[model samples]
Target: MSRPMNDPRFAPLNLALEEALSRGLGSGFALGVRTQGGERFQTCLGLAQRVPTPEGLTPKHRFDLASLTKVLLTTPAVLALAAAGKLDLDDPLATHLPDVYQYDPNHPVRRVTLRQCLTHTSGLPAVEPIYTWGEGKARLEALVLQKDWAFGESVYSDINFILLGIVIERLTGQSLAALAEEAGFAVTPGPSLAVATEACSWRGRMVKGEVHDENAFALGGIAGHAGLFGTLDAVLNRADALVFGAALPPAARAAMLEKQTDDRALGWQIRHLNWSGGGLSSARSVGHTGFTGTGVWADTERGITWALLGNRVHPTRHTDVRAHHQFRQRIGNLVQGIFAN
Candidate 1:
C-alpha cells in the first residue's frame, strides 16, 4: 500500500510555502515529501503562468529543472556503465576521448577522472558559451578534454557533466532522453506543463517548452548537464528510487549512495557537516539544485525528500535575485522541521 499523507510535522512546510507565495518568492511551486514510514506531503501553489490566462501555471505544471539534470540523467547512466564494468572512474579523460587531449599535451584535464567529474573536482570551468562556438559535439568534446585541471577545488562545471553525458551516449548508443524514459519518467506532452526561461537574442525566440540553458539548447535539449523537461511528479519518483536505492538491491543502493569525498557519492551530492543555511542537510541526504530555481533533496536519515519546482527565471531572469537564496534555505528549514516533530 502507498504511505499515508497526514502528519503534523508537515505543518511548518505548508506555512513556509504560504509565506513564500506572500513574499513573491515564486509565482507557483510543487513540493513533495515522502517520509521514512512512507508518509507523503505534497503542496502546490500560485499559477504556472503569471498572466491570468487559460494556460497559466497549475498544480500539474512543469518547471525547468536546470542543473538538476546532472543527477537525473547524466549520473544514472554513468552509474549503470560503472556497474557493468564498461567504464572506470579512475580512467583519465584521454582514455575515452584522446582527440581532446592532443590539442595540448599539458592540458590539466587529461588527468581528470570520471570520479572527479562526478564530484565536481575536475577543475574545469563551470560554464562556457559553447553554443556560440558553432562547433558540433566532437569539437566541443575536444575543447573540454583540453581544459586545465584544478583538482581539489569545489568548482562545479557543466562541461564536466556534459562530457560525461557524451561518454554515456557513446558507450550505450542511447540518448539521455531514452535512458531517462527507460528509467521511469514520463515526458510532458505539448509543452503544456513545461515553462519558458528566457527570450534569447541568439535563438531569436522565447524559450519555452524547450531547454532554457544555451549550451543544452545548442546540444538539442538532451545533454548530460542539462536540458530535459517533465512533470514534478515524474522527477520526484525517480529521485526517490535513486536516493533510497529502493528500486535496486540493498548492496547496489549502498554503493551508489556511499560517500566518496566530503559528502559526494557516485552521482548525487551528499550532505556536508558545515553546510551554510542548511544546504540539503542530513547524513544520507542526496539532491541537486538547478540554475532555473529548481531543487530536490532527499534525506535518507529521516526517510524524507523535498522537491521544489519554481520558475524564478520567468518574465525576466534578472528580477530581484535575493529571493532565490532565501527560498532555498526556507525550503530546507521547512523540511527539517517536518522531521523535528
Candidate 2:
C-alpha cells in the first residue's frame, strides 16, 4: 500500500514532525517506514542546520549516526564474521586482538569475550578519553587494557565497542568504514546530501558530514561505538535488510536478537515501555538510538521498520533526552497508525 502524496491518513505524522521541527527539537528530520507487505514510505523536512545559513534536509542528506554505529556497523560485522566461521562470539578478545591486550597477560580484560563486549557486561567504564591518553592507536589500546575489568552487571560502555572495533579490524584486516560499506552503509555523501550536526566549539565550527562523538572524533572518526553516517533511505534500507534476512542468516539473526542481558539483544535494545519506540512497540520490537538524535526500530513479528534521522544536537550538543524520547514515541505511534491494516 503505497501512500500517495495527498494521503490524509498520514497527515498526523506530517503534522507532528513539522511541529517538532518548528519547535527546534531538531534543525532537520527524516522519517522512513516499511510495512510487512514490503511497502516503503519516506519523508524529509526542515533544515539541516539553522545557523551558518539554513540548509534544507532531504532524503539524500547524510546524518551523523552517533551510537547507532554500534548496532549498524560493529554488531553486523561481528555477526557476519561469526557466520563465516572466522570467529566465535565467546572467543576471548586476546585470542583475536592480542595487540590490544598486550599490557596485561593475566588481566581480566584478557578473558573478556566478544559476547561480553557486545552485551556491555565487560565491566569497562562508561567512558574514558582514550584519545587523551596518547596520539596513537597503541597507546589507546594499552590504556584500555590496563583498566580493571568488571563483569556480571550490564552497563552500557563505549569502551566495549571500541575494543570490538579493534577486534573486527584485527580479524578482518579492514577499517570499520570498509566493513560498514560492505554491510550496506552509504560511506560518502555529495555536498548537498550532508546533514549538519553540532556546532563543535573544539573544532570551531558546525559538524557536517563528520562524526560528532568526541571519543570517536579523536579516534579518527571511525570507532566501534560511533562514527558511522548515513541518509534516511540508506538507514532504512539497512534496517529492512536486517529484518528481512538479507543482513544475517537465520541462525545468526536469531542468536543476535535473543535477549542476552539487561533487556538488550546482542547489539540491539529490546523495546520496553517509554523507550524510543514508546507504547507503539511490541515485545518483538528491537531498536537502537544515537546521541545525535538518530534511531531505528523494527518489529520482525509485525514486519515494520521505523527510522528517524535528526540533527538534534545541531547548534549545540545538548538536548533533553526525555523530549526526544517522547518525540520518538509519538512518531512511532503515528507511523504505526498510518500503516495499520
Candidate 3:
C-alpha cells in the first residue's frame, strides 16, 4: 500500500514480470523492499484470480507462503526452543521425540540431529505423498518418521521440517498454527485478503483462502512444511529481524547463521549463483523460497529486506515454476542494482 503496484519506480522490474505473466507465469505479483534506513517500496499488479471470481493482486493480499513456513514459522520456533534451553541443535530426534523410530530402538534415524534437519542434511527424501498415507496429523507424522529413510548427502526435504514441527509441538505443547499466531506472523486459515491458488484436481475447486500444499491441507492445513498465509509485511518482518538480529538472543542468532553445509545455514540458504537470491547477492546474505511462488531475501551487509509474493500457482501448479525462479533471481539482481546505485 505504500505505492501503487503500477508505480513507475517498479516499471523496469515489472516489465520483465509482466512478460512472464503474459506468458502464463501466474495471475499477479506483489513485492516489498525495505532498507535499514526505513525506506520502503512496494508494488503489485495483475489479477489475483482468473476464475470463479476475479480479483486484482494488492500489496495487502495474503499469499499462501508455501514452504516459507519452514523458515518463517518453524525455524523461529526451533530457535526459540534452543534459546530457552529446551533443546540443543546437536541432540538427536530421539532426544525430543523418543517414539520417532520406536519400531527400531537402534534405528540410525533416531540419531539424526536437529542441526542436520535444519541444514537439510538429515538424508531424508526430498518429498513424499504424505496425505495419501492417511488422515490426521499424528498418523501422518508417524508414517513420515517411520518410513525407511535412505541415507545420503544433503537434500532439501519437507520431511525435515515436518518432523521439526512435531518436535516443536512436543516441546511447547502448541500446534504450529498457535505458535504462528503467537509469533504474530500474520498467518491464518482464511484471511480476507487471501489470494487464489491452484484449482486442485483432488479438491475439485479453486484453492483460495486455505492451504495449497496437498500434504499440508491433508494434515489439517497447519504443518511444519507448508500452510502459512501472510502478506508482504510478514516476510519483510522476518527479513528485518535477520538483518537487525534485534529479536533473537545472541546465541540463537549465531546458531541460526552457523554454516551446516556448503550452501546452507541453519534454516536459511546461503546466497549462491543461479539460486533465487540471485548471483549478485553478498556472500553473507541468506534467503528462502516457497512453493507458492513466494520468497524473501535479506542482504545483511546492505541491511535490506525484500519479499516477493505472487500467485504463480493460481489456477494451477503446472505452470513454469522454473520461470518463476528466474523472475525471483532477476528481480533480486535488480533490487541489488537499485540500492547499489
Ranking by TM-score: 3, 2, 1
Cα deviation at 96, candidate 3, in Å, is: 0.4
lDDT of model 1, residue 340:
36
Residues 202-234, model 3: lDDT tens digits: 888888888999888888787888888887877
Best by TM-score: 3
lDDT string, candidate 2, 1-341, tens digits: 33433477778988889888877789888888888888788878898778888887766678888898998889988998999999999998888877555766877778888998998888777787676666666656666665665554557999899989888888888988787777666443433668887788877877777777877777766789998888777788887787675688988888888988657899898976577887766788899999899999998778899898897888876777788888998998887677655
Local distance difference test scores for all models = 0.71, 0.80, 0.82
Error of 3 at 26 (Å): 1.3
Q: Is candidate 1 or candidate 2 better by TM-score?
A: 2
Superposition-based RMSD of candidate 3 using all C-alpha atoms, in angstroms: 1.8
Best by the lDDT measure: 3
Could you give candidate 1's per-residue lDDT for residues 225-339 as a string of tens digits?
8876756776777788877755555555677788888867876777775332255466667777787778888877777877888777765677666667667777787677655
Instruction: Kindly report which residue pairs in candidate 3 clash with one another.
Output: 5-44
Error of 1 at 122 (Å): 1.1
Every model's TM-score: 0.86, 0.93, 0.94
